[model samples]
Target: MNLRKEILVTGAAGFVGRETVKQLLAEGWKVRALVRTADTNPLAFHAGLSVQEVGDIAAVADWSSLVSGCDVVVHLAARAHKTGEGPNAARELFRRVNVDATVELAKAAAAARVKRLVFVSSAGVMGDFSARPFTEADPPQPASEYAISKWQAEQALREICRQSNMELVVLRPVLVYGPGNPGNLERLMRLVASGLPLPLASVDNRRSLLNVRHLATIIGRALELAEANGKTVLLADGNDLSTPELVRTFAKGMGIKARLFPIPPLLLLAAARLLGRSHDAERLLGSLQVDVTLKTNLFGALPREETLRGLIETGQAGR
Candidate 1:
């Protein structure tokens, strides 16, 4: 935690990136935020922070100057999962950004003699749902184009770092929800705030979720923990919530009363189909959990209440 230590963070204007940079700065690390452009980046001027405009991840001509003199690199940029694209098109794009560009950056970091490279991977690399809690020990079962790309990136990074002797930390985090990111959590927050009757009560499912700040802390830990070097860790907030539980928690976080009623799972699915929200409904009812039982966490959990508070302080419609 020396004040002189410096870090390079890609996707520095992103949801997790902003918080990660803030955390590192608060902990006495100088940060160089690699952003797409100053026009779109939201980070304010800070003495300890510097902004560098490097366009799209896949098209960046070189990463040598970007990563030079930085002790650590936290790679958080990737092609997020989206629909309405052809599978072939999606696969190629994902590979370019998630795999090709990632390995490119890692190679530059190694060549620059960066001390550590922390990769933010997706738990989707293990598939959407698991029969039990997932662990790093589980074999990757990437089913989506995006997840496959991340898996490939992790593989390439390990080999690249091994040859160069740079430390690599791969983190597979499940369902990270916070202020600016769009996901099931944001939409659910709107529904809960709308004061509509939600028929998600009595629904039983557990999803291991992480706060952006918690994941940021873990990213910092990856730098400090020698035990975490060269290891892939599955991270969660260490608290799993059922659908109804999540609704209630979000409601409480928003200071709204949850209006949940019991509806059979089949009936809910049928209603979702009628409303053309079957995909969202399925995610609401599905169970995706991970084991965050790692001994090197060093920091404790950030409660659901704190995550909700973050939403109030920093929610942005689109970023």
Candidate 2:
């Protein structure tokens, strides 16, 4: 059924984008994968894959040519937070790429009469941590510049699609672990690999993680499922683990002993705050979860082993 449907995927060379393109092709879908000039094609040549080089997404003057024959547009390209960048600068750049460019693409897709636009958004829009599981109905409190841009993009897309014939599906996924995971998760995995004794044993924070591959599978579901249209869903692997447990799992995946010692959680948080890394500390020493408490479970829960495999796979991939 999907063989005849060509999905246009932006950022097709990114970590998640690469996996998603593969997943869609594996599911017998045709893919028009977009790659940046500097980024290598994510996958080996396949008959179902068509790679399009779009140098810089924000600078793309015309999106109509890209969306002309596509059934769905899986938007993933966005400016990520760079190290040492100021908040104001980050906000402006993120708005340009994440918000402005996303709205433009959505508008183009609508004009092209594309059936759906599946946007991969961040769960961080709810903030770095949630006291309980979050739901779609929760009012977003985007904490960082990057998150705020994503929230704004979501709103813009919602408003645009509301008046257009095209459908919209927003997926807000939590920390994803996989080959080439580029943020704190990758840092922590490397930290565990370094065998540094982490003083996080006492930090009993519950964090929900998703696999990049699982996220790709979810993207496919969002593409085909009629119920997913017009819905912004929270995504996670459903295996919430504490800081110690998480570190231990990382160690287990990497085949090492987790050298961890106990420390007062408040002391850790306070020290992190003094260092202006409170948000990063909170992710490790706080509880951030998502559930179907509101009865909006669009997908079934994956198990602890899948997360373990995701970590192990991350280890093997040298990410």
Candidate 3:
């Protein structure tokens, strides 16, 4: 029943990757971390980790050598943000890193005889902004290039696993937030700290979120559970927070009062389009909540209130 064996973790320097490695080590697994750069001292504090410098996930030579003898491979690296690029360019970049490189690594891991491959995919692959909560059974209707790339990567891994007889477990996690989170969550916190009366209060859309610790724990369980093989799981905190509630909670967590303004969502969207920032508006005002019934049924229901409290406490301490 012990799944703790030699494991290779791609993107070991990243946020999720680092957390995964730490948790895996705590579970008494021999972890071999693949890093793009030689300067891995930041992650050198952990014991029983064999660090290897591999240039790019796609062009890395001898991937079989890196993963050979490993029992599992956890792929976590990808092109996350679009930045200031056109849709085509963004799609190409995502394809190169998220799709093509991911498939190559999965293939290499299977070739190396790795027992299981855990892919960290995004929940965004479910579809566009909608009022309905997405479940694993929902047909994928990817809206953006990033989502498409993730979908393609999932298919590639599934196909490779089918042919190579490798156990594949895919995880679709919602907006993962925690300490040291350097994404839109951080930006929102900063905005709240600025004491600006935001118009987002009127938008009543629920969103699912995952704390980093909970995500790592679920991943650990997935690695151990035999039934998780060839299964895709959606991971979330099981509590859907509205836009206003999230802002208020974040403010409360930081010991600050939120200056909220109730503004029409349609007007905000129009303004964002006029300002050439429709993407920002869509991400903030959009509705993309998910149903965690499958995850709860498989991993047991996570303590939602406790997890949210931990997130707030961690955020406050970090600030």
Per-residue lDDT over 116-143 for candidate 3, one digit per residue giving the tens place of the 0 to 100 score: 9999998989976766889899898887
lDDT of 2 by residue, 224-295 (tens): 788888888888887778879878877876778999999899999899999998767776888888763321
Q: What ranges in model 2 sit over 4 Å off? A: 84-89, 292-297
TM-score of each: 0.90, 0.94, 0.94
lDDT tens string, model 1, 183-254? 567667778878899988868888887878888888888876888887888888777778787777666656
RMSD, every candidate, angstroms: 2.9, 1.9, 1.9
Taking all chains together, the TM-score of candidate 1 against the true structure is 0.90
What are the Cα lDDT values of the candidates? 0.82, 0.85, 0.82
Q: Could you give the candidate ranking by TM-score, starting with the highest?
A: 2, 3, 1
Q: Where is model 1 more than 4 Å wrong at Cα?
A: 83-89, 270-277, 295-319
Clashing pairs in 2: none
TM-score computed on alpha carbons, candidate 2: 0.94
For model 1, give the 10-residue run with minimal summed lDDT.
310-319
Error of 2 at 22 (Å): 0.3
Candidate 3 weakest lDDT stretch, 10 residues:
82-91
Residue pairs in clash, model 1? none
Q: Which stretches of candidate 3 lie over 4 Å from their true place?
A: 1-4, 82-88
